[model samples]
Target: MKYKTFQTIILISSIFLSIGGCVTSKPSAENNTNYTISPPVSNNKMVHVNGTKIVDGNGNHIKLKAVLLEGWLMWNGTLWGAGLTSETKITQRLEKMAGKEQTELFRTAIYDHFITEKDIEMIAEIGLNTVRVPFNHTILEDKNPLEDYSARGWKYLDNLMTWCERYNIYVVLDFHSLPGGQGAFVSDPEFINVWHSEEHQQRTVDIWKAIANRYKDRQIVAGYDLINEPDAPTGKNLVDLQKRIISEIRKVDKLHMIILEGGNFSSDFSMYDSPLDGNQVYGFHTYNFFTDETDVKNLEKLSELAKKQNVPLWNGEFGAHKLSWIEDQLELYENPKFPINGWTFWPWKRVSENSNRYRNLAKIIPGDDWKEVAKGISDLFGPSNKITPEFTKKAMDSFIEAVKAENIVYDTEVKDLLKKY
Candidate 1:
């Protein structure tokens, strides 16, 4: 079934407990000094790798409970109510249907309102010290030869980094979608498979090198996520490509930590025979349908792998289940014996009313035919259909309004859960 279709009936009842408490304590200088020296200092300190732990500038072990900033730079049709297969297609279609000027206006509005300074401040208030910003590779370099790099794309990222700095939150830059597409999903929009194309691989490396050079000194940038959910059927191919990217990144900046994900949508790690490089963390994605036993076993295996390689393990993406499931996952992650270094929830926000599993903290009205339009280019899978220009305009207008209003429906329960960690 299509992802949209499956989302409707995937709900399972969950019993949630009201977990609440508050502590009032007087601060003593002696206690403050002892706590301050511990890992994860409250101050805005640069984060780096220290053996198997991610530590702050003060050498305190830091655990990043972060939220993934999705559907912003990297547009997901299911989340954004834009029926396009990829971000490039969305922009091109919008420009064609609404003219360049109008398209630019809509794009600007989306970027400005999607996750603003207020959102970052709220994330900080929730006790999340980091955010994973996912972006399409095209944002950096739209051209093939990598000659004309776009400064406009960098502006959005720069804005986010600035906000992160202000909120004392570390940012993890994720190259979510790559040129020529790394996987078969619509999000990975390209004619050829990236793993098979040497040109695409080189361009990917060049993009990371560029990013490293740009944000190497930014303390708010915690690390570089080489790629998001790479589907490498041939595990060796993905492993080799990641190593090359790491080598390229190291050439420019060695201060920030590098995050390397496993093959097959970040679920398999058998390909990793040894540590790829120093100051690197192994990333894996898990969505085990809230099965506690399975989730625990999966995490245990990954943690064992991390131990074997003497590297830290991070759940780069998770969530899309009941709040109870989220709570259970967090509990497993915080296990003392098989402790997970950190985790970033799958998404910070999205619009949906049927089920809460994959819904974001906020919901918006998608124009009438949103479901039909979201079916994607019909020629490939279903009947061909186009969203009328009038409909597009109305949708964009309403979305822009929602963006500006920024009246998000806060998930206080989830927020409280995160803050406790």
Candidate 2:
């Protein structure tokens, strides 16, 4: 079906339950409710080698450059769109918009109410293969009273496993927010101590044990992202703790990949010494366009370690501000000289935009982030893993051609988008 126009209307739909507290969701779907969507699928291939990391039946790597799943469908509190809420009405919209079941990978939000069995089916329809699940520690513990972090979440998670088997996609479980939030300085009081605390470290291990034992039999879960971005009270201790956590999960579920991010949330590729049972994947995040090229060079260094280890490395999450940068990244990936295992971009959107906040995350939706990076990057998926050297060169050349063809620095859509933001 085609949507000629969309309207936003306010409706009251109560999702309250005694087992898990609920509330009335804010504006979620469009007022124009003339659409058809399939529910989530439950026939995933969920393959694994010896019940652990991804591998071919013959012990080869499974190469797939999956797209990064963003919360374009709903907000859950991070930067950008998260500022719009202040713990009040945080998860309502998400819960309301979830469970389309056509999507493959849903990069979860700080509050992932968007999770529903029907949504898993929608993922299968979209031809997606996995969900790169992001979570805050509180999702496992519920530090806030009004929030939910109950063990009951596992009941639903098992339902997700059932879907993965029916639909076949790997799960990259990322710990986005730690007890003290993963960064250097978190204004949120819950993260007052940082990862250096013995309390926080212990809590992390315990949580993983619960996570691992819960789905040890399901091989679709590729690995556990040790911690999100640990810039806090920075030191070698965070690295050491990661090795220990790997040990913990290894003991519980030895058949899966264990991914660890770089130092600065991007990739600093520090040296750490904790070994897994030879089925681990080293991973990192990249937002270098927001940083200097020098930082990117540092992150690129991880490629060497990944090669030496014969382990695959993926940009767990990354997206650029412009279309040009998307192609540039693909070039880096195609560099047989500096091959990266796979890459996933930031998001995919469902909503048009958030009205109140001019600089909201949904900004990337109708206009900015998702649109600019989408086709540009997807186009770079050349026939063989080889990124045609001429590809990015051609992308740059296209802009130059546009400038000469129109003799204009500002395109119409760019101007309108900038004005809107």
Candidate 3:
């Protein structure tokens, strides 16, 4: 758990030196009895951290310039122009108003079009080498007590990996929403507070274990981001859960990197004394809403910790600011003094809403009718006011069409900015 000297940490560099730079682990019978594990095809590069730098199978350094496929698997209310309501409430309301079957159909359509092979092609065209995919727990596991694992959720990831591999891009599978909930915001739909429930913690471990079991042999996967922005009661609690998750994952898969984010919105790392896993990266998220000066200071402190611990640092999530400010952060990430590995922009697409402060960052326009649907589900809509079922149906259909890569208009400026870096 603790390292006495940095030299001891350097031993991690030898952990992966195989053809794909991975220690291959066979699929476990108990977890993956029917699943077949295939050897990675020829010349597929696996990524691992070498002391302080992230490198590919050939020992070449790799900076993970990525974008978060935000609105794809996880339905963030804000991304839908529905204000800051929790995904739980939004889905429940839609089900109630639109009927369960209809709502399910709408969800299926959204999932199908939100991010397809076309999106992956666009990401590759943008010249970015990586994508950080944030998926809610509901995508993979049953809600609350957590019982059954969904095949649909697994298919989403399976599809993504296939597309990313074809496009020659790596993926960081991010568990954005935990079992019970991480409390507040659109990320946690149930809002039950995952830190308080032992069942939820175990469920979290099981989810990661299943993920590791499923993707153990897939070299296209860059890493597993354990949890996204854990808002635990204390840093120790956060670190404890992360350690457990990492331990469980290593049991099934040890080849891929394990990315750990700090507590309190990934800003606090005082609890982490040393790296828990050999092929690991410390991820942090920042919008730099305060002053620009603090951005440098924050990265300086994180960069120093990475060096002290002898691991790579990553800007996991960012970019809800002006393009110029985001470009500045990208510059800082590349600075020799900081030496942070790379960054994944907060979100790739969202509805352009007037009420949203980060509206400028939205690349695709969801459609004019999206605002009406957003208001229908939002708290501001009173009982007296009603959105007819016909209107809802029409809007939902429009939404499905709008999210398709070919259907929606893209903010070329944002693409141009990302391509520049």
lDDT of 3 by residue, 272-365 (tens): 8877777888999876554444387778888889899888998898876666677787788888887688888867777765423342433456
What lDDT tens digits, residue by residue, belong to model 1 across residues 1-421?
A: 0132333222110000001000221221121111111122234355776667888777789898788887788777546655425566666666555566676677667877888898898788878899999887867875423224377688889998998989899999998887766665633444555665667777888899999999888988888989787766467777777877777777777678788887645877888887777677887887754343337777878888888777888889877667778778888878877746889886777666444655354465555554444443222453233656666567677766655425656667766777777
Residue-wise lDDT of candidate 2 within 51-151, one digit each (tens)?
21245434555643444344322223332232323121233222222211211112232123334444455445444456666655655675434435455
Q: Could you tell me how far off, in angstroms, the CA of residue 52 lies in candidate 3 after the best superposition? A: 1.4
The count of residue-pair clashes in candidate 2 stands at: 32
Off by over 4 Å in 3: 1-45, 142-149, 186-191, 290-294, 354-362, 381-385
Considering summed lDDT, which 10 consecutive residues are worst modelled in model 2?
Answer: 1-10
What TM-score, over all chains together, does every model reach? 0.81, 0.59, 0.85
Number of backbone-clashing residue pairs for each candidate, in the order shown: 2, 32, 0
**Ordered list by TM-score, greatest first:** 3, 1, 2
Question: Which ranges in model 1 have alpha carbons more than 4 Å from their true place?
Answer: 1-45, 82-85, 88-104, 142-149, 186-189, 289-294, 357-359, 365-387
Model 3 steric clash pairs: none
Tell me the deviation in Å of residue 26 in model 3: 34
43 Cα displacement, candidate 2 (Å) = 23
